[model samples]
Target chain A: MKTFRILGRNIRDSFRGVWRNLSLSLASISCITITLIVVSIAMILSANVNNFTSQIEKDVTIVVFLDQNIEEDDIDSLYYDIDTIQYVESITFKGKDEIAGEMMEASETYDSIMSNWTHEDNPLQDTYLVKVTDIDHIAEVAKEIGYLENVSVVKYGEGMVEELVSIFDMIKNVTIVIVIALILVTAFLIANTIKITIDSRRREIEIMRLVGASNINIKIPFIFEGLVLGVIGSIIPIIITCYGYAALYTRLHGQLFSSIIKLIVPEPFMYNVSLLLLVIGMVVGMVGSLRAVKKYLKI
Target chain B: MDQIRVQGVTHTYKSGVTALYDLDLTVEKGEFVFIIGSTGCGKSTLGKLLYRELKPTKGTILVGGINVGKIPNRKVYKIRRKMGVVFQDYKLLDKLTVYENVAFALEIFGLPKDEIHEKVVKALELVGLKNKLKMYPRELSGGEQQRVAIARAIVNGPKLLICDEPTGNLDPKTSMEVMTVLDEINKLGTTILMVTHDINIVDKMKKRTVLLNAGRVLKDYAEGEYTK
Candidate 1:
């Protein structure tokens, strides 16, 4: 009960402090809001890029065309060999007849051209579609599979896959740097803002110290002030990120260059992002106030 | 019992300025002692040492039997709770009213609201400013503001009250009014250690006087003693 009463008083004083210095508090809140907005935007971009990269990775598969004159019994051994490769996730066999049928069904022109073709006359070769666990390791896996006996040709979108991987890597690195820089800048701005408040209240703190107020008693209010500022600063950015992300997701859900690429779904994605923004805001606010109050609280 | 005991206490600032050097003084419980000194005579430094504001560089200070110089950082507040300190420039929060200012001292201890109110009212009543409870610091006169500061200091019923030039900012008449409040508080058995440059008040009060000159005690006298 005593602790609660102290907390109540601290919170009350924090609000009083905030109200007493409205312009400075507003500046702090604005700084946090702007910083969090940039942070959230970066997070959303990273999430989307991650989603796009994974979709592209899923579409990457090496097609191994078998020699037509190869014995049928060797197919099982070939499948087993490809499956044993470390990076290969799965390998599915497609007979020549099945490939011809799929091609004929996919296009009317192909259907007309191959309408009269029978199983014996089909031109397609038996193939293995190899899926790798990681896009970066796909080239290595495909190269190893190319040397397999009875494998006539091995093909994967090597150029496009390498370019996508590098692009995603660059994006990830830049996002980390940007997020770290933003956090430091936010902490600096917020700390300086809280420092101004502390400067104004220096006499009040001195009196509190002289009058036997415990360090915690004097510090709790400023901590509460920082927390309140952080929460207020994050609210607008959270709202904007949520609604804005949902809108962007709706507009660009399946509209990427390739049908296989996609944006992350809005519900869980925005929920997690909102939670992240709030937590970051709170931590940044607290840390900023803690650092700012250290010098003034020597008493 | 000795309310304050300073034994060879020497205080040096971080900038290598020694404010107090081998200064030894003692004040008994309920005694009103005036620490009269010119500027930079180490009078204010001694007052700060009593409140554990500055630890002595070389000597020990015992306030109410506790070694104040060695009091840990966490226990500093506990030591301060037993004493009240008033400053030259009445350090009252401008945003707070007179009533709130006095209550602030008790509020810090997390006293019950009603109890805080009663104590604040009584303290203000002692200072004869109970009628100006609603007035802000800026709204009150210089002497009235100092009275509020005294009320704040004494509201917790501290055993010792350290006033570092409480009347420095007041006129002769106003200073007398503030001094009367301190005297009244001192009469109630709260030992008062007042550091001041105003020889008029010190000579008029004729309390036990300890003269500090250049970080050392020049003279110590009982009541009714006067010095030029």
Candidate 2:
């Protein structure tokens, strides 16, 4: 079709424009790359904090101690009661004798003193170790269990909970603010690039209009130009990030990524997902430039 | 039938004084008409109205039976495709070769490549620029550049070709040469409407001359001579 030929001509023209305005094109791309890099870092840190917190929460368990004199029926009834609560993920019933024996085995700490106390003479109380559906609701759950009949004490990992939560909140806020600022910067930079390019070609655009070139035809080349610049910019950041992460990961864990500290122990998938920030950066650059051309060209 | 009509047209700039006032004129099909006026007169404004570039603050202009003033904004592009426009400045795309400039209009119409190449070659050859097909606009002499512009305009074989002071910036000898080409193109039956202040050139043609003074048609003379 004739439209195909025109599109081809415009593509070639746009390619030529990128080279002709070398300094402006470079400036625009650099602005985009820097903005993307900052955005990518924010993304990486956000993932890091999320992974770190979830790991801590999944590892920590709530321990609820019951009175030693509690009957088997009362224990079973309490178990059923706690099981029905929405947040109670799963519960493990540890008899006092089982707890004291496990404690003695864990203590290379006080083996001689701890071994002197037999399972029959165990001072450790019977406890229900509870896991929650999510870490954030642990305090409310602990309070509920503490008030239950026959429950002597309910211990939530309060200090760890506070630390993980504050870190998670901080990571989220910082990531959002940084990403917003970077996106705004990218948009401003790309818009100025398009505006400058259009300014230089004002005479040509007007003449094209004179010859009955529709606004759509006049702008296709410039939009293509912006796309080319954005794509190039995106590649630069990706290469640098790939190399940076590759090297850091090598020093930290393998050729692909340090998968484990020990050969047998595997790293989490979070590391792989973190590398996706580079892809996020690329998409950001591409979309940012496209938006710039769209806003100004207005076909 | 009149291929072009202007009725009660008046134009005033932001300065609040009329440039053209209550002008009325018509040109039949295949007519070669010249509009002549002094510097302060509305010769250029009338040319713009004919092409629908500047709408008269009050009046109506019709070209090829289309009421240009009442044309909807979206359809303006369709109306323009039916006409060729040339300017004294030549307005050539400096970046494009002479051949590409001529082909631009057909390309805008999304004509097939084979058709564009065939027509572009024909148009350039008609304007006597076939040898300079690869030459950029900046490389050509002023007269030659204007010829390229002419080549571009007629490439589409538009129903109406409106030229505003097509020779204003040229030397006397070059001006006459361009006029000869305009005359030659006219003989082929594409109606030519030219606006000029060049009374010397106007007197030499003496075809259908419409004399515009302060926006009104002061005279309409067939086989008309240049007049004060």
DockQ for all candidate structures vs. native: 0.65, 0.51
Output the number of the TM-score-best candidate.
Answer: 1
For model 2 chain B, give the 10-residue run with minimal summed lDDT: B70-79
Candidate 2: the clashing residue pairs are A253-A258
What value does the lDDT take at residue B105 in candidate 2? 78
- Tell me each candidate's RMSD, in Å, in order: 2.2, 3.9
Judged by DockQ cut-offs, the docking class of candidate 1 is medium
Tell how far residue A200 is off in model 1, in angstroms.
Answer: 2.7
In Å, residue A53's CA in model 2 sits off its true spot by 3.2
lDDT of 2 at B77: 69
Candidate 1 regions exceeding 4 Å error are A70-73, A251-261, B14-17
Give residue A140's error in model 2 in angstroms: 1.3
